[model samples]
Target: MRLRNKPWAKELIDAHPELIQVQPEHVADQFAQKQPVRLEIGTGKGQFIFKMAQLHPEINFLALEMQHSALAVLLKAQVDAQLPNLQLVVANAENLQALFAGWHFSEIYLNFSDPWPKTRHEKRRLTYSSFLTQYQQLLVPDGVVQLKTDNRHFFEYSLISMNQFGMQFQQLSLDLHHDDTTWAAANVPTEYEDKFSAKGQPIYGVRAVFHQAKG
Candidate 1:
């Protein structure tokens, strides 16, 4: 989904130091007072990160997105709410390493990321092996990468990629909507999730723990 360029987005972000990071230097310092930083890649419009930060105030959240419009919306909401536990960055998942420098996260969330449904484009998937390696480097020991998606093929590919990478599957749910008593209660639905669930599409989830030593 292409978002319209918010010409004022950069200015808004610059004005809100409490909500967004204009520079990547000393990124970890933003959450110095909080424990166990958690990241949500592709935080579309920021609904999931907002709810997650609200629910888990002890864990600081860094929401990353590529689009200026999405960042603007999320940052504006963060500025208005003054959510000290939450911060955002307008960056792509591919450059996560350079963006965070040597910082690491305790958990990473991938919610409704693009499937990139093509054999040639498989490497672009968030759970692809190469990205998994990067995630492994960025995660603390026993840290987990959790994913939720409405696309079955993408979910299956993620499982295969993690398995091939020798990561342990801490949790797996093929149909998240089926078990209402569990994930449904804990899950903060993204905009895409709400739309898909309303249309009767089931969400798949996986929590894979990294075994490799943190960098």
Candidate 2:
């Protein structure tokens, strides 16, 4: 998702300190409720996370996306909606360990993440081992990581990476929209997923858990 820079984006996001977080150190305290936390990485336009927060009021949602311009659009909606359980942050993935330091979530969501298709850029993919390590550190033991994507290469790469990282697959669907599975029945569509699926493309999805610490 590319957009012309919004100069007011930062100031607008910063103004709503309770709903939009500026410091990673302050993320843990953003929510008004003490509930099980779930995180969504790369929240593009925030459709999925926002809907998730609405659907699951029992859980606190923290959305992490790197693009301030993209997040600003969603942040405005979140502020207007006044969803007490949802919080947004513009931050880099590399600093996740420090961002959520002393915090662990119940689940992490990766929705329509960039594939970083070039072989040389494999490390940049969200499912790369380094990112998995961060997810492991930020999730409770055996916590689930759910991923949904429209890219076959990314879906395949993520499955292999998660397997190599000692994550046990609990559920997987090669074609989430068409598959007749319980997980697919409750699927949420990100804009990217909806656009691709509308063109008859299959959406891939997986739910996996870190069975044990590896290294």
In order, what lDDT does every prediction score? Answer: 0.84, 0.88
The predictions' CA RMSDs to the true structure, in order, are 2.3, 1.9
Runs in model 1 lying further than 4 Å from the true structure: 212-215
lDDT for 65 in candidate 2 is 86
> Which residue pairs of candidate 2 clash?
none
Task: State every prediction's TM-score relative to the real structure.
Answer: 0.92, 0.94
Positional deviation of residue 32's Cα in model 1 after best superposition, in angstroms:
6.6
Q: Which candidate is the best by TM-score?
A: 2
What does candidate 1's lDDT look like per residue over 112-207, in tens digits? Answer: 999999999998999888888888888998898999999999999999999999999987887787766565568788999889999999999988
Which tens-of-lDDT digit does each residue in 10-73 have in candidate 2?
8998798878876667766777879899999899789889899999999999888889999998
